[model samples]
Target: MKIPNNLRLIVNMRFYLTLCSALFLVNCSSKTDHIEMVYGQTGTSLFQLKNKQLAYTVKKEGQMVLDTSLLGVTIDGKNLGSNSKISFLNQDKVTLKYALNGIKKMADYKGNIHSYEITEADGFKWKLEFQLSNDGVAYRYKVPGSGSRTVLGEATTFKLPESTRVWYFERDSDWKLKSHAGEWLSADISEMPTVSKMGPVQGLTLTCELPMGGYALLAEAALYNYSGMRLKAIGNNSFKANFTEGDQGFVVDGTITTPWRCILLADDLNALANNTMVASLNPAPNSELFADTSWIKPGKSVWHWWSGKYVDFREEQDMVDDALALDFEYNMVDDGWEAWEDKWKKIAELCSYAQDKGVGIFVWKHSKEINFPENDYTIMGHFLDSVKQAGAVGVKVDFMNGQDKYIIDFDEALLRKAAERKLMVNFHGCQQSSGEYRTYPNEVTREGIRGLEVNHMQEGPLTASHNAALPFTRYVTGHGDYTPLGFTEPGETSWAHQLGTLIAFYSPFNCIAENTQFLLNNEAIAPALNFIKSVPTVWDETYVLPQSKIGELAAIARKKDDDWYLGILSSGSSKEMTIDLNFLKDGEYSAEILADDIEAQPINLEGLNKEANLRQWNTAIPFKKLTEMVSVEGKVTIQLAANGGAAIRFIRSKVEVK
Candidate 1:
């Protein structure tokens, strides 16, 4: 069937017109209105440098809202909104600055009365940009000329701002309650937080405001190139940075330029104390199209093996087979995988086995030591080539501590090379991903938080609480591999809590965080695993739902095909709670709910495929009138115990799909 040339021309014209319209909207939007307050009591602000004028102002709004500025529109007669303020925690302070030394505007942001030309450059292009007001101060620097490499990733920050008195419960915590920083940064910078891409996406992050007016930053970076997104330290080849009182921000004045680079700057400790925002920044592809926004869509659930901390080369084959039977996609065989001379070949075999079982393999290797003695991509490329030859899907690269020009260059180079090899990556033990995922899709997940890995504990802190609070905070920005699943593991406090984590945490490749054999102990947890498999990583709507002291609860509803997966997670005590099914489609459903069950046969992992039928339910729901109800719907009333939760799979057959 041949079509007319005129009709074809019209279609082509429409397509180009649509593409041009989208590009213009993305590149020409106002910067001042990017960060606006929709609703809230916190005093926030928006600022930008354009049209030869520096406009800065304050604002306040509720959660999940952006701050807007009519001033730019009023002053120049242009209705433009800039992402000047993404989001932030509740704290009172003044003076903030962020300086980026390598930023070259790609296009001009033409405002009402002003316009600034854009410049595009590769490598470390030196530049400085900062902002200071009553709200806070932020300083940033970007280094150019460095290779387009991303070495560091998943930075877990620990900061102590200089303004804390005795413990006050009203405050998020006497020592904790600081998850909103990631949101604040997202709202302010229009960016997402990132994690390291190492060992199945589990890393650490902590930032604190000290008692006397100082702040400390702690983090980790990855060595792999998932989709070519990463961070690296440029100076000292070290992973730690400190800021003293009276300092503008993190000092990179004398930092060396290795394959990694990093810089810190702040106006005061108080402002530093109130700043924290982390999430995936760049847009990721949904189907490996070099540029698909769906790929960048934030994922909150993952399954992996590192969380168990199990290291045994002899048992690698058995472990790999077990991981496949459990319905996991990405597996991380850390540490010991690289201990032998032909270890790469062994890993290749394991990857081949995993692929046959419908699972992707991500073998682990240290960033600093990989290809060591030789210290270059040539050797690294050979190793990656072997992994690819063995049918491996991805690699978990670890441990880059700082962000230097060289580090950034190396990171970018590695991503490019990894992309060429058709291998995805997971970065670990490094800095935040500002938005590199937008450019790379194979780079699936990273770790940049103090995750649920039963590791060393610090003084006076509820690490578990911090872990629970990250979803609404840092996760909003990007995909986070919090590494939440565990059964008979060292870090989990309760079985149900571990189950709830599947709902609380977000990641493209959510790690299982448990030993393969350990899953056999709790047959009840099979429902949780099934829930993890049934639920989609992307989301439609998310709400804190409710906040409490004992533990917080969160509700998330995700859509895939014609079904909706609604998950409810609780951290504190078990109790009866109500939920409205109004978000669901209008009609009846056959729901298979996997929740806290006191009495259920132990789950046989090998027979997991057969258990799917055990949890299904037949129920009727009317979402049309659901909004008018004062209480939760009848079927929504679920009973949860301390550290217990539920995952409901709503399959509506009342309406047929085309």
Candidate 2:
């Protein structure tokens, strides 16, 4: 069905009759005038013109949304709209292996819109799945039955014409262009207005103009991560992903690997948390098909004491000792170790001590420093190995500004090696994930956005927008190591807000990033940590629950083997949140409340600024219960000061067997 450029027009208007329910047909002159469209029976259509010029219209059934002047074809609702003009150098030179969905179950979806025939070029064969959906178009391609090991999708053969041009749409006029190789054009529209006042959809547009007179415009929500760009590659492969664009696409394509598989998320996490996918697609986990996956484990119940700019191992040892006392399984020693290799030996000395206390230590290493003689990859690897040698379980690799293909390959290889050596990984300043954890389970966490730590360190107060914005924005593609659950100084909220991080921030190896000495002062809040630690990061389900951001409030819930941990948070405001306790097994349970004292309480942020006694924490609150939803409701009201919030933990009681 490839259209020849010489063909003036192919208007098989008859196909339109088959699809348009007769009501969609419009009376027009039979004389092929300025426009021509040939529709197909299998939910596909083709459009072409002789002079390489075009114009058209696309409309959904009931909505008044109209997109006019579109010159590309669409399958279902997906538009294969490229801004770059494509020329077929060899139409007859087909490669059956260069077809889409050739990798089979590894990259192809079981339910897809189109099945394309394989093209043969020399001895190679390729399959291409070019389909359209109500939302956008997608191109899936693969080389049939290639190597035993996983090869980059770009290694296939989809030769582009000598020169092709492409462009994308944009909402903002004045945009900055950055240097990204293989990237013809780049624009940023982070400040666009919301398309709708509510609901999942927020609109932002990105346009990429190719050198060859063509362009591609991707219009999506203003949110981050959930959006993407399409890339035309050599051979038969087309790269499409969220954030990652270029040859690096082979290393970290979000659509193919980490499209937030809801089932995998459910199996890895919990069931009640599964509601986040009501707005989008979630690839089901492959493990559940035919095996007991109990070995598939997860956890984020630890403490991360950052070493970046602050490398005090002696202090860190004290912190480790404190974490061990708190019964935490993991403790991360953040950035800044190469400079203190001397300190590492001392930290290494206490490694067995920490382990003897049942605490696993995680060291921090720089990704680029892996090559320094004093700090190269070998020594860094040895450093990690030494930690392992000393009985630590993991290392958090950070500060990788070089997110190149080689860097990605090296990082993945590093994780694989570390896993083989029985060590876990946490990435910082790294590229977006590609579900490599399913391939290498030890890659436990990542810091991909401005997380809570940013809020504590000399920034404007962490707005409710940061929490409300993440789900549709950052959390769409993969897990985030947002280092949740700390009610110490510098936070503009209460212990409850910190508690909610256990639910809001989806980090498997959770970090109670504050000192345990701080929590011991508030034993009531100590139980909140126990509840947080008890809840598994791997859940049966996860949910971005319905709530209001008007008054600094957010909530999330996780399900773990019949126990549901629902954590609710409110920032510097007194607002009521309604929880359907009915979701729990019809039973009564104790609710641990952590709120702020409404009256003025002396709080300090000195410790956050490298000063002693950062902030003295104090809170006043009324704790009550609800007997009936209609008659009386029990909620902890927190009129918190700036940087103050509240937390509530729903501890599910065991149900009696009948």
Candidate lDDT values, in order: 0.40, 0.41
Q: How many backbone clashes does candidate 1 have?
A: 186
Tens digits of per-residue lDDT for model 1 on 170-247? 112211121111211111111112211111111123232223333222222221222122212112211222211112
RMSD versus native structure for model 2: 12.5
Off by over 4 Å in 1: 1-55, 60-314, 370-376, 404-406, 455-464, 490-493, 520-522, 526-529, 539-551, 596-635, 654-658
- Runs with alpha carbons beyond 4 Å of true place in candidate 2: 1-110, 117-127, 130-138, 141-297, 300-313, 336-348, 371-387, 456-461, 522-535, 548-553, 569-573, 599-646, 655-658
By TM-score, how accurate is candidate 1? 0.55
TM-score of each: 0.55, 0.60
By summed lDDT, the worst window of 10 consecutive residues in model 2 runs over: 96-105
**lDDT string, candidate 2, 1-658, tens digits:** 8776555243445556455523222211122322221112112222223433222222223211112222322222223322212211111211111111100112212222333333222333333333333222333332334222222222111111222222221212111111010111222222212221221111122222222322222322111122122222212212122233333233323222212211111111122123122122322323433133332235443443532326566666666676665666766766654456676566667677676776777787767656343323466567667767766678787766434345555565576457656777888765444444444446677765556565445432344435543433344445667666544443445555566556665666666666566655555454455664465665654443455231244455555565555555555546555554444555555665555444534443344323222322323232222222110133333343343344445555665799
For model 2, what is the C-alpha lDDT against the true structure? Answer: 0.41
- Model 2 per-residue lDDT at 495: 51
